[model samples]
Target chain A: MGLVAVTWMNCLGRCLPQKTRFLHTLKGRQSDQILMSPSLASLDLPDTWTPNSSCQSIPDIRKSFNEQTPTVIDGKLMATEIRSKIADQVRQMKKCLGKVPGLAVILVGQRRDSLTYVHNKIIACEEVGMKSVVTELPTDCADADVQNAVMRFNKDPSIHGILVQLPLPQHLDEEKILDALCLEKDVDGFHPLNMGNLSLRGREPLFIPCTPKACIELLIRSGVKIMGKKAVVIGRSNIVGLPTSLLLQRHHATVTIVHAFTENPEQITSEAEIVVSAAGVPSLVRGNWIKSGATVIDVGTSPVEDPSSEDGYRLVGDVCFEEVKKVASVITPVPGGVGPMTVTMLLVNTLDSAKRMLNFT
Target chain B: MGLVAVTWMNCLGRCLPQKTRFLHTLKGRQSDQILMSPSLASLDLPDTWTPNSSCQSIPDIRKSFNEQTPTVIDGKLMATEIRSKIADQVRQMKKCLGKVPGLAVILVGQRRDSLTYVHNKIIACEEVGMKSVVTELPTDCADADVQNAVMRFNKDPSIHGILVQLPLPQHLDEEKILDALCLEKDVDGFHPLNMGNLSLRGREPLFIPCTPKACIELLIRSGVKIMGKKAVVIGRSNIVGLPTSLLLQRHHATVTIVHAFTENPEQITSEAEIVVSAAGVPSLVRGNWIKSGATVIDVGTSPVEDPSSEDGYRLVGDVCFEEVKKVASVITPVPGGVGPMTVTMLLVNTLDSAKRMLNFT
Candidate 1:
């Protein structure tokens, strides 16, 4: 027994050397880039802080930190890269299995916004070499019609992902319909189980909501280190703000959420190293609300009247972009920013679901 | 059409009155007595700030703010109040249903801690007019032995709740065993679905974890207005910290969680109006760590060596109670604090589960 204990101790001594390991995690669809930490300009952090082995290292985290010219986080370029990679995967899968991934959408109304969202998703699916199916029902259709559509898609072997265009006529119970989707095909990541997993530290969500996923992916690809950063999320909407806050928390960032009744919103946002605004109020966030070196991701897509535009209106974000850009180290543009990434992430989730179904992982 | 629109407008005008309504939400089993907010003494916030009609009115919130004599939150007294109420209900339930609620506990090992816990729970059950059953297995018992016991209890009609004491023998699969228990009998609130529902905004969890429930109930009954207040929860343990954070968020408090990786813990806690410490690190938090008017709930019950004491050891919480009592407007004592509330809350959950099973709310 003494000899065995010595042998075990010797084995542990050799195997568990106190070596420092630099860990880098590239997560979600936009798994590639993160822009920089503005204040880390001198590269002093690497020498001063030797974190534990489990820490996720951000490559070139300070590449543009505290630079005179801010590093613009180009979401459009990153989305294109993710799309191409997904497209390549789709091609390979089709060749190997003689089958293509399919995404099915159940739309209840012909509301212009909902129609536009579905069209974008279908387009995104087609771009990635995946098949798309749409089940359109009248706005006045009963809740049973929507549930039947979801059930059909859930049963179909080809349909790996199911999406029910939300704000499904006020008459229908949204929670009931969403909860009914099979856990395997719930690519929206809004199911209570997926959300619970997301919120819990050890649990993992099957799919992260498209908008928040895009925001996190963009941050990762841009090279932002979320660990230990003070992050403030504006708005507590279930889809965007809530999930984004949870995702940030999972990344080890101390996250605070401020909403309608919160006192002194600007003070909170201005103190954060990372600010994600999804308040849906046009131009609510101004330059003064941002910290000098903060990375800001704008998820708001509110329409503001613009007399100069041909359509007499233009899409603006929660942040007053032009002014905030001057103060912020990196900021996502509204039209060219989170919008394209949201559509792209949906395609990514569908492809992932399809891959899992095919034992591809 | 114009006449009908005018009539409809007039009808809407009468239907939506601008009168204020107070909403007091008493959630989960530990439903009464959260002591006072300490710093509300000098200010009559109600007269000064009549918020929107949707605000909840917490009576006498400003009773002893910054007083020389700090408001000591008596958890022992509050727990007694909750237990008696539960006892009365259990009596009424037994009278009506001709059967009493039963709680079945599966204890795998004869560890001193586990034995004491089970003994206490059995005592609590008896005190509340409920039946208790303990399935004791030897230390060397196989995983199947525990699983079978849980399965048996799940099928038993009398058993309304099932609790498998945690930290089961190292050889066992904890997650799998806990997940196997029937979710309906998951009165401990550890099931993934219940946890998931608890994390989600609109969904309701079957049961809130006992410690957090007691903490919230203590705050509510004691009259600390949670809505819009800044709260910082130190520790992110699944059972205590994470669920408590979610509960606070649901109650509209702006919450920040400081965990193992968080830098400047004191700075973060000092900023909060409410601090709930569950770090399980004895004497980790001192008086200087707390803000002048903050309400402190200490959930840490770590045993420390005390040669002077009769037992040669004493249970100390994360906060240095003596020091913190001087600074915090209201604070819970270690022995009489969260400990009693936790056991009382378990009984509350069991009774609630039984009531629910019997078609009573």
Candidate 2:
């Protein structure tokens, strides 16, 4: 990790490429600035890892930031409370309307991670006393096969929320399949119209993406003031960074998004009062890279090797947790923080969809 | 104006209503902070009014900013160049295919502003040697009336673009009318699907919102470096601020939007390297509010009283032009800056829509 930090510093100091005349079709920065420095947290370091010198002494820097703000945002507790509320709502709905909410998920491939996600979604539905079904297809399934399943779910009156698991077969048209789902049943909120409505001021999306929704929920529950503060969102993926940035701006935080193409990502993050790192890169954001006393929401959940652990692999966020925890006023832990909240939001969206569809609103 | 400013400040200082928890439905900022201060330049002082004490000495401040950057972005010149290119394209299409691209606008009401806008758009089309049509309906027209006109144009091959003038009658459903237009013919980019496409990654909107496109074109043509630079957009209106902020993000500018609900907006703007003021307030931004070397693109065009002028009302932007000029590296003038570029972009969208339909590209 120390060697990587030194190498990263040397790279940042190097002179950039020559300039060119401005043109109409210019897509990116003309300067030869190197973007997307390799994340240092994923490095195979000895168990006795010493902190980088320039990034050291968090306790000394702690005095400079708001020492009063020692609150560590407890996401796991919040998720449990929300889930209880959902379960109660489900019980009341069953008693009054004689029906419970239903969710249908379409899993296209046999990827182990995707199967796990689908299984967890089913379990969440069951926890709330809701009916859930998963339509599994082989890895080599055609686009038509996925579309037919989604259409069946869309037509099923019992299924109020329809979710199509991501990373479909390479040959499948992801956009077409996602677009085919009925707008009312698109609980995952990946539909284009839903995304558009999310962006427009007066127009509201039928559903909010789970991950971004979870991040905002954590911020609000933790009493993180976003109004008029400088915010930096790493990564620009449609599912996380882009929508998260939009939500931050709507929440009145002045937002800056740093992605793979962004130069000086760390410098930008340091200026932010609120940092939401969604970039999948492990340890991309170091402790020194965060603003003192700033609220850090680590959304990245990449698995990193840990020889000392029984599993030999541990989940980590984009932030260097141990280092950032010392400086940040509040930070979300990887496994317990954003992860559980995402599942809860998905369930919440599904329930809301059911309420709207069943005229229980 | 002085009375209004004092009243606005008093309102800002008052404690806001609270106790509402941040739920999924909570859309905007909770706390309010005084964002804009009265622009000293707009004060009804003598012609020889001096600068504010804190903002005195332009030369001393000039040295603090980049000395070589004396570029004032001339939108009129750039517009002329772009129109010429469009005209050339139009002529080529006419000669090669023996057909000209046509645009159809549906105006539902007789609002004077709407009339003027439609007239200007038609004139813009004519100037580029393209065909144009306007379907003006009574103010009391039903939603079906607007829908029928849009449907007719959607089927007309000659009519490659369809635009619905906004601010329909109180009884008319604006969303219904917009959604009724064919996606391919949505030249205004207001259709939820088109907007969704614009907001989503990897999905291309049939049209880019004209004003946002113009602002980006001006930035690119003027050689403004957006990458890794902090940018502030002053407004959150769907037509301007929201889309402009999105475009700035797409251009790799670290974008922050300061809306009416924002706190300490001047301080936020002062941190920006590029400022796009789209708030339709006259002289809401002052000299001290701007960063020394920032590029200011004023999108606001509110009419302000000017007793001495030939017209009782004169147009002004959100920025206090004379004062911001001294501090900003580049500034766009109100009458010529973003206005012409907006009309040009409408034409460009129409031409692009035509080219797509005619297989010109």
Candidate 3:
């Protein structure tokens, strides 16, 4: 393992810049040097050094990475562009058919994050000229109340997409409520049938989960080639990691999934050309865990206490951003990365669902 | 790469026997050496040799490998044992509820292979004291004819399981016919809903696809640990490769799928501790593609013309078995491997379905 790691690092270091040009073109951003903590900058070690070395004798080599330029993927910029296009399409649909896409959201509880998410989704729908509806129920609401809300939305012809806010109250049966949702209006794409279709080769899902869709959209729009690449997706949650891994295979990437149970994850991860971390653990993926010239999509967002922020907390992703950016050819920043694209993709899905329903295409 | 290959060979060579002892106990078979051709025996290389070496100077090392004893996983023996248990349970069900499990198969057209598969399923059903029914249609039959047959079985109270024989005349709508199958009686587990449930983390499919289930059964029953292991599944077909990969992940193995579009599949495969090849190509996976002491499950079966056989053809697997057995810690042979286990698993699904329906434990 030691010998192989050395050979891989040397080979990748020589080929890094040439392979990263395509990804750099997607953002049109020049690589710039930034200061990082010396504690986490393991990738800055000298070529003669190995992973087996003790840190006590090693000299700091962070100064050598001053010229290391990696493209910081701009997800917020991409989301704005997509939203503008969707708004144009929604206007065109309204002019032709006198009706636009409609999204219905069901929020069962008062969790602050869930409330903010639901509010953001509603605002996003409105920004794109789509009708929005929200049904807020008490935390102690019966299972029938949630099912009733879903059934009502399912029958409404005006609604093109419907989503039940996740992490429902502990008393309610989440699976049963989700199962009651109409497959057509399941814009969240949490339905098992939609997931099954996504997993199968010839079958197509009606709607892909927004976060996974967002990750793929970011990759494609950034000019990254997916076919035949070795991709390692950390975590296997159904909503993100599992579907993203399945989606990558659909795009012809040989994908490996590294979850909590996987042994020697860094060794496996270091071999991937594409790394997507969705484990929701902050700074879990370090610099040495990444291969040079790899494109990293960080989907993990966990709240960390920050006295400087208005809310006294801020979001951090799975990748140690400062250290990883110097090593990765392309990397997405936590707050402005996959976070902004999810709601935008929901709008895309809603528009698509409406177009299909109205037979306007 | 050369340096690392030599190091890996030495390390695995020293530890192979101990790591394989648990799997060997599953069959209680003594290590017996067998003769092999000189051409494919690549693992008998000396410690100083690397993968970069030219073949001309190497002397024959076949005699040294005469002591290599790998446990041949006997799927036929396991299937027989499982079927006997199911038979005893079926008799108990008859005594308690005055009814036994029933399997209904719908066969379209007269494809010889399909006919043989259906016949074998029926015989297996009878051998376990279950009622069996077959519905055959002509090659030119209309779509509704197949649907009607499926519907009849769906409505029959005595039937606990239903399966539509695959590769139905190419003109027939295979997906639509499968979609018509009732989920409860979908013993083949080809329905999209069942597949969807299987893919979800918290959801459970009513039945798992038989072939993939058979592969897992072989691994588990043989005392092979799946958790925290690396598994490579070579193929992306919906039926075998895809599901087996999903099942392996569910068992907590970090899994990678190698399909036709994948580059350097051998490199990815050589890193795995578990390799399941379902590519259906004859000898597609060679000796050098596997790591020492890996547990190889070959689900590939393609018939090759053989004048010595009574049928004028013999079945061969994806792995070059003669070569792989020398390196693999545990291996399953072509004729008696996963083939028999598929039918047996179908029986298990049927009996479980019957028990669920009859409210029996």
Candidate 4:
């Protein structure tokens, strides 16, 4: 593994541009210099270097990175464009068919994040000329009660799409409740049928899960050429990583997935032309781990302390942004990036569901 | 790719015993010395060679191999054992419940291989004490006629399982016919709802597709040690390869699927500790492409011409048996391997279906 890592670093140094080459060389020189500094050389060392020695080089590296250029993906703007197209289609459908698309959101409990997400979805629905209905259940609601709610929505003619916010109360069976949603009405595409259909050759589901779809859309709209490119998706969570890898494969990308148990994730990530980091651990993806000029989609939204913020909290993506922005050619910012696109895709799915159900062109 | 192949051959040679080593060297010496003795010097070849390259070296190789013998897993015996268990359960169920589990097989047109396969399935059902019904449709049968046959089987109270042999005459809508089968009686597990249910993390379908289930069973029964192992499934066909890979992953194997159009499949397959080849392409898997001592489940059954056989044909698996058997620790023979076990699993699924529906355990 160490040999592979060294070989890959050498390869990258040789392959990158002059500016990136200088930075990488300087970073390496400084790190080696710090290790051989007077204070470090005087002390007995363990098998591995200590945090203090590692930290000695960080301040200088941070100063250098701060002056580096930032490459933005403009996810919010791209999402808005997609939403407007969907809104226009919805308006045309309503005008010709005399009916508006409807989305039914089932919220089991009041997880703040879930509440906020649902609220954003409702706003997006309204923005897209679709009707939104919220069915909120108490925290102590029984599994049967939630299932019945889904069943009601499944039978309702007006409800073209249904979404049950995930991480349901511990007592309820998540799989059973989700499976109860009709395949056509399952806008989230978490249902196994949709996934199976997606995995099959020559088959496409009525709806693809939003986050993955949005990730691809964002990349394509940003002019990232994907055909025959190498993509590494770090994480294997069903909702994000695995499906995203499959979607990329569908578009002819050679995708390798690096999960938590993977032997050497950094090496794999560095080999990819496109990297999608969904591992929720903050700052897990470092700048050096990324290939220069590669597009990074940071899907992780970790809440970290920020004294400058009004709430003393800030949402940081999985990538160490300060460092990664210097290396990545294009990257999606944590708050304004994948989050908005996800909500927008949900609106599109709901509208599509309605159009399909009503046979509205 | 060439370097990897050379490394694999060296590893195989080094891993073998002194006798095997001697045999290989002897064969090389004899082939070059005896068969090409006059031409050896002229051809600029080594003097050490043999006529029967492999055969001449076997005795000494076998002696050394015996000293450091690897565990041999008998897939044929294990499959038969599983079938016997299913047969015993079916017998007990029939006696106690007073109703034998029934499987209805719908065969469209007369593809020779399909006919032989369906016939074998019927025989397997009878051997397991389950009722088997075959509905054969003419090659020119209308789509509606096929659908009508499926509907009849779906409506039959005695039938607990329904399976339509694939590649139904090109004119038939395969998806529609598959979807029409009652979800409860979809023993093949191809129904969209069942597939959807199977894809969820915690959700288990009433019936998993037979061949994939058989692959898992073969691995478990052989004590192949799949947990956390890197598995590569070659092919992504819905029926065999894709579902089998997913099932392996569910059992904690880190699975990589190499399908058609996948670049450098040899590199990927060689890295996998366990290989499942179901590409239906004969001799597609080479011995050098497999990791040392890997377990290979060959699910392909392509019939090739053989003048020696009464039928003027012989069945061959996807793996080149002559070459792969020398390297693979355990491998399934084409006809007796996954094929028999697949039919046995179908019986088990039918019986389970009956048990679930009748509530007669």
Candidate 5:
């Protein structure tokens, strides 16, 4: 048929020349070149704002927009370089699958801040070499003792990850012990089908809830750039502000949230560029609810009785970190920020649920 | 103990007097009295802005904010008064349980707009007395012939809502025939555990997706006071702009969204008071992206090529409706807007999944 429409117009002119040079560099560009093209920070974007084909490039988006000072993201040095590369991939999957990753926990009572967050998640699952259990219970337990300790760690085949330790004891039911877990060892993604496949858009959420995956792994290991910016969040809680505003609209930004019946929450967090907060309600984000450069994060902690330390009480967050680290460009800090990356993203979601239950990739 | 701290300060002076008159009517008021107290229209609000104790009162929120002229929002006369009140509740559940609500539908190829949307959802389940089937298949069927027609209406006990009809032809497997339908007969809520319990917060979503439950039942049957207002939404599309921005943040507003990597989306939808749009991109929301007493709700249609009338092309939507009915004060009209309230919210989610599978309530 006329040589298949001239060979399909020369195979769509070689598969559409990089989407016609990314729509001819977004024609007559200037909305400050699509807000300095941090991949056009989105909420549900993706209509051709290519930007050196993803993952920041134009000189690292002009050195994160001409950096001047602020920065401080750290999150305990990116959770010690992501728990030292998940403890060298759990010592190379226990030297080729002799079995490594486990992580159970149930801990119904003993609230000394939930026994120091279950002893710092059993010392971060034995410093990443993995395998750690728990159970605990008492302090007037019984909702069938926390769903029989979550159905015995969901029939523990060397428990790939379970976790229960939340604010469990007010005559316990806690959504019937988090609906007796086992949505493949939930890993604390707070299963409602893993928060509905982390708020669906080509669904994919096996586990994401470690303080909103340590606030998007401290904004992608601090290179920042959450596509088309303007975030916000603050707090909606269901474990850290509604899955960190559904993981900042799956890293396409343009989020918003705000909370506590947002009357003017500092004029919607002073028109954010990325805020977060997670209002546990201490400072409740201040420094004129920032916007000067914005990055923030905070994830609110809230203890506050201090009487000059020595365990009288300390903690505090929801930003006001020295007045939002002087108009934030990037901030983090409350007691080594996002609290040691929420126990290093629960040992990286229990070594990715033991490499997807030992298939070990 | 000092007369028991004076009888616990006279029982905390009679249980904190309506939270001290809702925090003394929110101290120095003005932030336009908490955005004119439509129950502090929120995204996550709820700290205490009592507003005549909920559900619109202040003279119907000042007569829907001093109405002027625009108010269209008919949705085909609210889908014929919600399909005549779902045909008088499916004829009072077929005179108390003789059984009526069925609604199956599978429909595979002959794509004349998926056979006119499974022939208008089998003529709106036989104009609501209910029971309607339709299978169709063939366009080179097999993905186990559309997952055995969704496991024969998930083992039909006279099926209580099934539905498959979406763009299903290009080599079948639409998410494994929608994960082999039957999360309590899904009734098209596009289950990700019912969109993770409709974006969690005291979860609850057995079914919702009929065009975001007819755009939140035409803004709560037109009273239109989605708490703490600021909305926006444009498009995210997991069927109607991410479940109508998670049902307008579960009716607490403060949303945002804006898509196609929004740069200024008309300066964030002209600082929204509730926008909606759904970007099936026809006119794509203009009239300075509204906000003069906004409340838009387009839900785009997009047909275009009109050779004037029938089968030539007509549809249209995504707002331009005579330039957003001159700066919206409440608009809708795109072929009687939101397409007959998405088939009257699929016959009110097939009579609420046959009154939740005959437990009948």
Candidate 6:
């Protein structure tokens, strides 16, 4: 423990020594120096000093893996709570409006992952007492075919929300197809009009983008404070990183984004109290890079070779989970973390869309 | 000058010494001292470094008191050049296609500034050999009136672009009026559809918002070297600051935005090689706060008391001009700089709209 403290102090001294020297000095002498004092008059300094040490020397403390256990936040559990809340709201809406909310999911191809994801989304919708419809198209379907399906759902009064599974066939224009959905039923909030409204300060989109909203909810459910905290989002992809940063900024968090071409990515990520890693580059963020006790929401879900696994493949996030768990106060695991919550959020969004369409809220 | 430099260094040391030391060492000596550098340096260092001192520090460079410093990139002159280019293109289109580009300017209120701006736009349209039409409505005009005007422009084949002067009457729904304009003919780029397209990566709007475009043109004309430079935008207004930051980012400059709620605003602003201030707060950024030889674009147009002027009012930018001029290498003076370029860019957009409609380009 003493050696760990010493190395942690040295590491912090290397990174933020000038800013932390005064507190570090107090921390270095606190145990021995406080005992020698005639009275316990200066204990307040120890309290403040310890937190700083924990924050600045996260890497060193995490090295003692056996001693420091990682706190695993159950994103699945939090997502279930949200779903239950949405279900309750849906039940009330049904009693009031005599109509149930419905969601239409359009899958363009038979990509196994997309099929599995669509299946899970349908299950989630059913779990939350919402009607779900799935429309499948051939891999070589024309743009007009996709557009026609979207128009059909748009005009269907029973369908309150519409979602198109992503990574559409390479031949199709994804942007044009996504924009074709009626903005009113764009529960996924990927429609250009909804995205534009979300970017504006005073205007709130009828449906907040699902993944970013789920990330925020996960952070709050874990009791991680967000107001006035510094958050860094690594990636600026429109789907996840950019919108996530904007949502965090709306909550008054000072936010910075480090994208692919960003120089010194580690330095920027290290400064954040809340880090959202959506870069999709497996193991891009290591344990040593995070601030001690910082909350990490790992949004990446890349499949990597895992010979030991039954399927011979395993899902991983952008952060080095094994390493990051040691330092992060609350960390979301890759496969069961943001992925499950994402599907669950779609259900919530569908229900909300239904409520809005039925004028239940 | 040496004494000024020393005093400036001392002040920087006292105010943000960690940042100053980190920047000096990082830029001064190109070594990987990532872990050893101060936290301030880690936070304040721009993602990219520009070698030219003047280009890096616009707000702190010495200003030329000589009234005829012709070397300065005159925005007014460049705007004329752009207007002439548009005029030539319009003339060629008329000769080849047998039709002129038409622009419709809708003025909803009697605001003096809006009226003056609209009049200049109409004049610019005429100067470019494009057709111009003006529609005036009373201050108390209903929202339906504005929407009708936009719909009329949408249906009129001859009207290529429709621009409704901003700060519309309070009674009128601004969003509704802006959204009514045909997406293709939305010259102001304020429509949600255009904004959505702008937010998407690699997606270009049919027309960009004028002031931000003008700011970029000003920098380019001055040879400020945007590629891989550190750019900081102070403020996040949808019109100027946010869009300008995005444009700079698109040009491959590492961009950071410092808004009203940003902590350590000076710490972030002073690190950038190029600074764009559009906060609308007078003197929010002081001279010493600027990087030496950086290019400063003052987008704020605030009216301040000036006994020397006959009207007892003077137009000023968000930056404190007299002080910053001594440190900045090149700066856009409030009234003549960005202001003139904005009006001129609007004409350019209108002209482009006309050319597209006329099948000229």
Candidate 4 per-residue lDDT, tens place, A227-259, comes to: 446678876666887678767766545566665
Computed on C-alphas against the true complex, the DockQ of each candidate is 0.24, 0.14, 0.22, 0.09, 0.15, 0.10
Better of 3 and 5 by TM-score: 3
In model 4, the runs with Cα more than 4 Å from the true position are A1-72, A148-158, A223-230, A252-257, A261-273, A286-295, A305-307, A322-330, B1-73
**Model 5 over residues B125-219: C-alpha lDDT tens digits?**
78777988888878896899888888988998988888887867777767678877988888888878888877876666777788877876677
Task: Pick the winner on DockQ between candidates 1 and 4.
Answer: 1
* lDDT for each candidate structure: 0.73, 0.73, 0.78, 0.70, 0.71, 0.69
Which candidate gets the maximum DockQ versus the true structure? 1
Ranking, DockQ, top scorer first? 1, 3, 5, 2, 6, 4
lDDT of 1: 0.73
The model with the greatest lDDT is 3
lDDT digits (tens) for residues A204-236 of candidate 5:
777888887777667755667665677888768
Between candidates 5 and 6, which one is better according to DockQ? 5
Distance from true position, residue B76, model 4, in Å?
A: 1.9
Write one digit per residue (lDDT tens) for candidate 6, span B22-74.
Answer: 46444423232111111111222222211111211113323333332223446
Q: State which candidate, 1 or 2, has the greater DockQ.
A: 1
Model 3: per-residue Cα lDDT over B215-246, one tens digit each: 87788667677766899999877888888898
Better of 4 and 5 by DockQ: 5
Q: Give the winner by TM-score: 2 or 4.
A: 2
Residue A193 shift from truth in candidate 5, angstroms:
5.0
Interface RMSD of 4: 21.6
**What is the lDDT, from 0 to 100, of the residue A297 in candidate 4?**
95
Q: What is the C-alpha lDDT profile of model 1 across A219-325, one tens digit per residue?
A: 76666667667789988777888888888777667888876545556766776888999888877787777778798999988666789977566777888888788
Q: Which portions of model 6 show Cα errors greater than 4 Å?
A: A1-72, A93-98, A223-228, A325-330, B1-72, B310-312
Q: Per-candidate RMSD vs. true structure?
A: 10.1, 18.5, 13.7, 19.0, 27.7, 15.0
> Mind giving the per-residue lDDT tens digits that candidate 2 earns over B96-185?
999998999999877756776789788888988999999999998888989999899999989998988877888988877888989888
